[model samples]
Target: MEFRILGPVQVYDECTGVLIVPSGAKQRALLGALVVKAGQVVPAERLVDELWGQCPPTNAANALQAHVARLRRLLPCGEPGSGRPHHEWLVTRPLGYALRLGDADTDAGRFRRLAAHGRELARDDPGAAAGVLRQALALWQGPALQGSGQGTICAAEAALLEENRLVALETLYDASLLAGHCHEVTGELEELVVAHPLRERFYELLMTALHRCGRQAEALGTYDRARRRLAHDLGIEPGPALRSRMESVLRRQDPAGAAEGAARAVAGPATGTGPVDEARTADDAVAGAVSVRMLGEELARLRGHVDRLTREHRELAGRLDRLTSSPVAGPRDLAS
Candidate 1:
C-alpha cells in the first residue's frame, strides 16, 4: 500500500490497484495529521484539537475513535495471505495512536528522498541532478492536501510541502542551466519571476538565462524591474548575488562562461578588434574573473551552511526519535 498526501489523502493498494480514501473532512484531517508525523504517537487531545479546533464537542474522544476505526477498515492490510489486520498500520498506544509506515510509503516521504538524492548528485553531475529533480517534481498532483480542511496542523503541512516543491523547482532550473539549457528554461523562468517577483534568486536566474540567450537588453531590463520591486516592497537593495548578476549583465560578462568563449571565437584575438573594443574586452575579462572568484567564495559559504543545516536536521531527528520511543502521559492520563 502507498499513501499519497502530496494532494488529498489517498491510499493505493499495490495488489489490486484500488484507491482507499477516508470519508468526511474530519477523518481525512485525522489521517493527514498522523501521516504528516508518521510513526509517532499523536495524543488523543492533539488529534481532537486538529479535528475540531478549540471548540471540540464533549464526545470528541469517542468521535475520534470512530474515525480511526473507519479509516482502519479502509486502509490496506499486509500481504494477501498474511493474518495481519489492516488496523495494524494504525497502532494503538497507551498515550494515543501511531501510523506506522516504511520509507517511500508516502508521496511526501518519497519527494524528500528524491530531492536529497538530486542535491547530492548536483555537485558532480548537473544532468543527473535535473533528471532526479524532474522525477521528484512529477510526484506532486496539485496543491498539497487540497481537500484537507483548514486546521492549524493541516495548514502548516501544506505550507511546508509547497515550500519544498518550490525549492525543488529552483534546484531543477539551476541544474538545467548548468547542463546548457538556458534558452529552454527562459520561458519558465519568466513565469517564475512574475509569480515570485520578490525572490531575488529567481530574478538573478532569469537574468542569466536571458543574457545567455543573447537578449542582453532584456536581461538588464529584468534586473532594473527586480531592483525597483525589491526597494518598493522590502525597502532594501538586492543581495550580493543579484547585484553581481546585474553588473555582469551590464559588462557583457558571462556568468556561466559559455558566452565568453563564444565571444572570443567570433571576435578572433584582442589585437584584431580595434583599440576601443580591445580595451572593453580587457575590462570585461578582468570583471568576469573577479565575479567568478566572488561566486566561488559565495558557493563555499553556501555549502558550509548546507552542511550545518544537515547536521542540525540529523540532531533534531534523533531527538524526535528518542521522544517518540518512550511513552508520555496524555490528557486522559493527567485527568486520572
Candidate 2:
C-alpha cells in the first residue's frame, strides 16, 4: 500500500488500483497532517488548533470524532479480530493521531527524509549532495494533490517541497561546475533562467559557462542582462558577487583558469586570442553564471556566421555578373 499526501491524499493497494479518498475536507486534512508528521504522534491539541484555529464550533470534538471514524474506515487493515471491536490501523488516544508506514510507505514521509539527507550531503559533499537531491526531487509527481485542492497542511508542505526542489537544482548545477562539467551545465542554466527570468543565479551560471568557453564579450553581456533585470524588477543594482565577476571579465582573463576549472575564469578560445590563450568565467554570485555566458556565446557565434555568409554571397554575385558580361565559356583559351 502507498500513501501519497504531497499532492493529494491517496491510498493505493497493489490488489486495487486507486483507493477511495476519505470523504470530508476535515477528514482529509486530519489524514494529511498525520502523514506529514508520520511515525510521530501529533498531540491532539495541535490537531485541534490546526483544524479549528480559534474558531472551532461548540461540538468540534464531536465533529473530529466523526472525521476520525471515516478515516479509520479508509485505512488498510491487516487481519480483523472476530470477538470484540477492532481498531488496528488508526488508534485514538488522549494525545493525538499517529500513522505508521512500517511495511507500507508514505510519499510525504519519504520526501521529508530525502530532503533532509540532501541538505546533509550538501554541507558535507556537494557533489554527492546533488545526486541525493536529484533522487529526492524526482519523487514529486505533480503539484500537491495534483491540484485536487488542499487545506493548510498540504499547501504548506507542498510549498516547502517546491522550495527544496529549487535548492536541489541550484546545488546540482553548482556541483556539476565543480566537477568540471561546465559544458553540460550551461544548457540547464539557460532553461532555468528562462523559466525564472528574475532569478539572478541562473544568469550567474550562464556567465561562468560563457567565460569557460572563451567568450569574453558574451559573458560580459550576460552580466549586463542580469544587471538590467535586477534594476528593472527589484530597483537595485547587481549584488556584490555579480559585480566582482563583471570586473574580472573586464580585466585580462587567464586561459589556464579555463583548463584548471577555475571558478571565476574568463578564458580564451582554442584559436588563441591572447598572450595567455586565456578567458575568465564568472563565479561569485549565485554560482550559476556560466549558463548565461554560454547563451551569449551561442548568439554571437550565430551572428558571426550569418555575417560571413552574407559577405560571401555578395562577393560571389559580383564575380558571376562580371563573368556574364566579359568571358564567354572560356578560361583564357583553356590556358594551353
Candidate with best TM-score: 1
Tens-place lDDT per residue, model 1, 10-55, is 8877767788888788888988888887989999888888899978
- Root-mean-square deviation (CA) per prediction: 14.4, 18.9
Q: Give the TM-score of candidate 2.
A: 0.60
| Stretches of model 1 off by over 4 angstroms after superposition | 78-87, 102-104, 253-336
Top lDDT: which candidate number?
1
lDDT, candidate 2, 174-255, per-residue tens = 7666656788777778889878877777777788777776776778788878877776788666777776777666554534
Model 2 segments more than 4 A misplaced: 12-24, 43-58, 80-87, 112-130, 144-155, 214-218, 249-336
Please, what is the TM-score per model? 0.74, 0.60
